[model samples]
Target: MRTSTTMPPLQALRAFEAVGRLLSFRRAGEELLITQSAVSHHIKQLEEMLGVRLFIRKAKSIELTPEGAAYLERTVEAFRIIAGATSEMRRQTARQRVRVSVLPSFAANWLVSRLADFMLKHPEIEVELEPTLRLEDFASDYADLAIRFGTGRWEGVRAEWLMNEEMSPVVSPALYDDGTRFAEPKELLLQTLLESWNPVGWELWLGEVGVDIRRARVLQLTDYNIVLQAALNGQGVAIGRMHMVRDHLAAGRLLQPFPQIVRSEKIAYWLVMPQNRRLRPGAEAFASWLKEEAASPPSPVC
Candidate 1:
């Protein structure tokens, strides 16, 4: 007695396709992460929309009706064609050059240093790095992949998580010898310049160390890299990301003063690509390589 709508939901079509292909609504539900009844409803809705019975219900098993079999054949062929086209596109794209967008801080601190290795390995795939803080539109934009900070929920784009952010206080060795005893977090703040990327940075670090941030001397800087460099010169104590300051910290250019920790706001780097466009082989390979590199622990120098 159910009536069909002007258009059926693509979800319903997908559910029906799965059920028809598998010939088991229960199995389809398992694959789709829906209850068997939900999968059955989707197929029923599809059947109503198409005005054709898609399956013959049996006591113990389900069988695709004639109409369902025909539809399954076409859908399977469509999927195969799409897969073939995607493969061809990847092959062609891999053969050509690739462009990547990265954050200035990440590029200067991490990626650029190790880029030569990637180039040496992938001689065929040329890569160009475009540094910017602004998010570029990948649909009409020129770059193939963008490294960004966030949960990767941008509209019309696909995102893959790269790494988590870790932060701590860093200062030059000279600052420790300036007769400034940083035995306690609160005492250290009073003696050194509290360089902060944002106002909450000092507060977060203090909170992590069980110190009151309100009593700390806070100095805000828009560019964190500058603050880190300033810290290296013994100008002040800067809260720095461990990933970015790995080399500096290891080189004894910057030293941690407290046993405190600050995790990033779940907005670490991500690899983004256009939703509509299939990843060219070069882009996909580069993205994968970047993820692996980012996840790997930085060298002892870093």
Candidate 2:
């Protein structure tokens, strides 16, 4: 018997597949959560290992070479088969835990409160939630489903509209009492704006109400939680994702000074799953329950 050393690393294969499909190193890196230089290195390593040039790199673009095209088909099929097997195994298990990947902001602000109803209803299905900004690769046997915030146009994936999104400015009651009032759009320009992961928010809100201030002060925070916390601490007024701030506003913890709200046209929360794949036993139940839970809360977007 002889042992063979002919298998390529999974990272290299994934990089190759992403690049081959997208035809751009930068886009592939964005999808795979690697640097463009790293993707280039992986392709270079893979090409060296196989002793063949995989991409015909040009000054502005890249195209898969003959061998690369051939290899891409096999790589894609291999990932698909592995994903199918994993899905099948999950379905076979009677109580496979429901693993859901979600954005941290949405998890903290919206889902966590409603999730108890789901657990209570479906006691047999245990659930694990992974919160991160990185998009889950469904072919890697990780998450059964994911709640993604986007325009519902992920490549090679199935996305269903979960909720609409709106933006507004929110502040603490103490900030209001301290005389930093957003009575008009001009006042917003005068004060420091709190921005979470989305930096374009203040600009977008300002543009929506036709208040252009080139040098509005912004306090940037890494996550929505921090941004909201800072706003609660009277640090600054945050451009609130309405879904996240609605409860706070209702509870009088946060104040919405102005009435104007912008309904985001480009993006919303979407329930995303692997394209052409069935959910696992637990995931199937969880997915159904999630939709039911999400059905009525968000007011209709006009």
Candidate 3:
């Protein structure tokens, strides 16, 4: 017996494979969008070229012969391998994109303002920003990295210190100019307290200064962004994180009424990524840029 080096036609193989899987020439033709006669013709050509009977034709149905069953198994595996290789190649091509998850307020006040420089530096990389209050799952492909505000400890991930937060009372400069002496922490209670989340920062800061806020008029908001906006509009006084409000204070849009700034030992900004996952080039580049940006002092208020 002589073996042929040349393989059979791809169209004939496809016709046979589809018919073998579906076990019906009519169904394979419907799947392949061809006529049932075309499917039968291709299978007949394939059988004649290979000198083998692949399927037993019946009046209403067809069944694979012994040779057909063995060939179908190999053909299906070959198609599966081709599909897997194609998917892997597509993923490699998309590696230039980096997805970052961050807090809404942080993204609005800090990252958005400075993101342009990073884009300028690495034009090849594309960044996708996802801002949400909920902690993202780094173990999955939800994000390439996350900038979270917390103590630098999380299970199953590597957390690197990004920046420490300092909280201070910020008021619109117009409010400060009204000559309502806010020299004392207790004085803030006289004005509406623009609060975020639990309003715990106000209580923490007041306790540190031995001031009571039991009677303070409060307007609790959903997030820090709204709180800061309320304070900027002179609606109330808000506890502003130093990193978030540095530009506003520097530009004289908002004023720190007192010199006291409180640091939270429990919460700070951190860069988190899954420890077991390797960083792709785009992720690595963004992470490095973030660290360098964090280490530098805030730009002088201009």
Winning candidate number (TM-score): 3
For model 1, what is the error of residue 87's alpha carbon versus the real structure, in angstroms, after optimal superposition? 17
RMSD, model 1, all Cα superposed? 18.3
The sequence of per-residue lDDT tens digits that candidate 3 reaches over residues 109-204 is 999999999999998789999988767667568799999886777787888899888877888987867877776788887899887776767876
Query: What is candidate 1's CA lDDT for residue 202?
Result: 63
Tens digits of per-residue lDDT, candidate 2, 134-155, equal 7777888789999987678878
Residue runs of model 1 more than 4 Å from their true location after superposition: 1-95, 150-156, 191-201, 264-267, 300-302
- Candidate with more favorable, higher TM-score: 2 or 3: 3
Candidate 3 TM-score over all chains jointly: 0.65
Q: Candidate 1 at residue 105, lDDT?
A: 76
TM, every model: 0.62, 0.65, 0.65
The 0-to-1 C-alpha lDDT of every candidate, in the order given, reads 0.78, 0.85, 0.87
Q: What would you estimate as the lDDT of candidate 1?
A: 0.78
Flag clash pairs in model 1: 246-302, 247-302
Any runs in candidate 3 off by more than 4 Å, and if so which? 1-95, 153-157, 177-179, 213-215
Local lDDT at 47 for model 1: 87
